[model samples]
Target: MAKKKVILFIVEGPTDETSLSTVLNRIFSSSTVKFQVVHGDILTRDFTSTSKIITAVWDLVKGFMGNIYHKNDICRIVHLTDTDGVFVPDKAIIEDKTIRNNAHPYYTETQIRTPKPDSIRERNRRKRNNMGKLQSCRHIAGIPYSMYYFSLNLEHVLHGKTNLSDWDKVHCAEAFDLKYGDDPNGFIIFMQKSSFSVCNDYCASWDFIKVGLNSLNRFSNFGIELPAVSQTR
Candidate 1:
């Protein structure tokens, strides 16, 4: 009568969480599945050492598992990290002793390659450039939607035209929120819609956060109790 738990681990960031959660929910919609997606503060400290990040993820996973595994139920953890500009592997490196390592290689990665200057002034300049492109297009309406599309357009411009496929557009809109500036809902939607949100060919990083929140919504609608990563905690 119990549900199977699928744990999703992510680095700190509302945008990232949204994308992963959305995809997981979309993938596992059956009644037999239960998910526990935790957004961690892996990037809080310097992630220069990959070992530290992996260790932190391991600790979080072990702590999340209570005394439920003995009841013939299994828990799986899927870790999603951002590659940024660095070239990390697409596969997840899991370190659980008992479990077959990376049993389900949902170990995914995203890139954040922004060639523009990191300084506030330069960053603003880059944002302005992207915004201008979005404003020129009329595919969507409303200021909020316009802003959202503009921001994404900027990403596309920086990375080159990504051939915004139908599915990609649908997910992208859901992934990036124009209303909430850095809100994660839109990104989560992107993740749920697209198999992969952010990759080398394209940089749709917002989808992860959007997708994750979507999962939470589905779980709540089904009356399923799940743990949330509270900011205060």
Candidate 2:
């Protein structure tokens, strides 16, 4: 029998893998669904720039292949990213001197509060520009590529909460897996019907999140990429 082509998912952290890997595997049973946990937001990473984003993604794909799979063995790359309120205006970023930690930035629907507002602003500027470049990127190193967003962050879109500690993130992902692991169709339905699900059009969904404070709001374009049940098989 021929090996199944891989459908690679590039995600920020392990919790994302924990939450969706099994369900996505079940949904895309015809292909091998694999998760590449990038450990941090590549879009906002200090070493990444708009010019290097595409190559960075391609490098990730190659890293995953790692002599085990050839480039042709991969069918597509689906990148799932947190919006992190990156598209919000500068005024929406408030420097709260009371925030003594200086490293932890907190998000609200209207603003992100932190002691290091300038750092956050710079991160946001880079993220916004990099994401804009990524949005138009249809392929990386000859492999089909598409990107999706969870506004504010994954925990917000998936669990209606944010600022979760690592333990909380794992707990929530496990709980989410328990709910959807055996019901891929149900997962699809939930993605489609959720209040956070953006419109079905891909471009429109990205546009919606970039407008005003919508990036800080609960929204996802992932549902737009979820394959229909019949198509999955």
Candidate 3:
């Protein structure tokens, strides 16, 4: 009876699109929410030296909306990117020590951060500088944008079940189990049945995602309306 929200999921690849769509659809059903996937380009760059996120995201947004236009109909734009090289292990550790650090995979730094730890003042300074450089893409034509980043890459988010040989494709949305990957419907069922909340393994991003989804109209129109909203950060 209520109107559905139009959400544009700007994902880096189809595999992401597949899993996310499947999960969200199970939660919101096919009627109360409509999802449109707009594929984005991953910039070719020496990522260790510089972050090309702004350039890549800008291309995706501008390509869709063009130079000047109002986007009131769109409920929210959720941009997803992976933290692939965020905390690469020291080469010598993997080579000589042969014992890699697990903290690298559990990297919690989402905002601009120094390569190594810094004093509070220094950290703030670098953060400000990075923010200023990124302001152009951060605020885009007044269109609401929220970002979701996967730590250590999407495969790691899949609990290292990255290989295609590990999973089965579900019937509806090509869903794959984020953890096991052997059962394609596992994730979708979990999302649909439970009051889904933040997962520690997801690298502290679930609440941010809730805020983005809340920006939409009637976001709680159907099943599992805004679960774990109270547990949001």
Q: Which numbered prediction scores highest in lDDT against the true structure?
A: 2
Off by over 4 Å in 3: 1-5, 26-56, 65-70, 89-139, 162-226, 229-233
Cα lDDT tens digits for candidate 1, 1-233: 55654433333334333333443353343422333344432423333243343444445544545665432333334333322211222111223333232211121123222222133223233333332333233322111111121112222312232334446644554543333234333333432333322322111322322332221111111101122213111
Best by TM-score: 2
Candidate 3 local lDDT, residue 78:
59
Compared to the true structure, candidate 3 yields what TM-score? Answer: 0.46
Would you list the rank order by TM-score, best first?
A: 2, 3, 1
Q: Tell me the tens digit of each residue's lDDT in model 3 across 21-53.
A: 645554444232333334432432223112645
Instruction: Mark the 10 consecutive residues where model 2 has the least summed lDDT.
Output: 224-233
Candidate 3 residue 202 Cα shift, in angstroms, is 12
- Give the least accurate 10-residue stretch of model 3, judged by summed lDDT: 214-223
- Clash total of candidate 2: 0
| Per-candidate total of colliding backbone pairs | 31, 0, 0
lDDT of each: 0.31, 0.89, 0.39
Work out the TM-score per prediction. 0.33, 0.96, 0.46
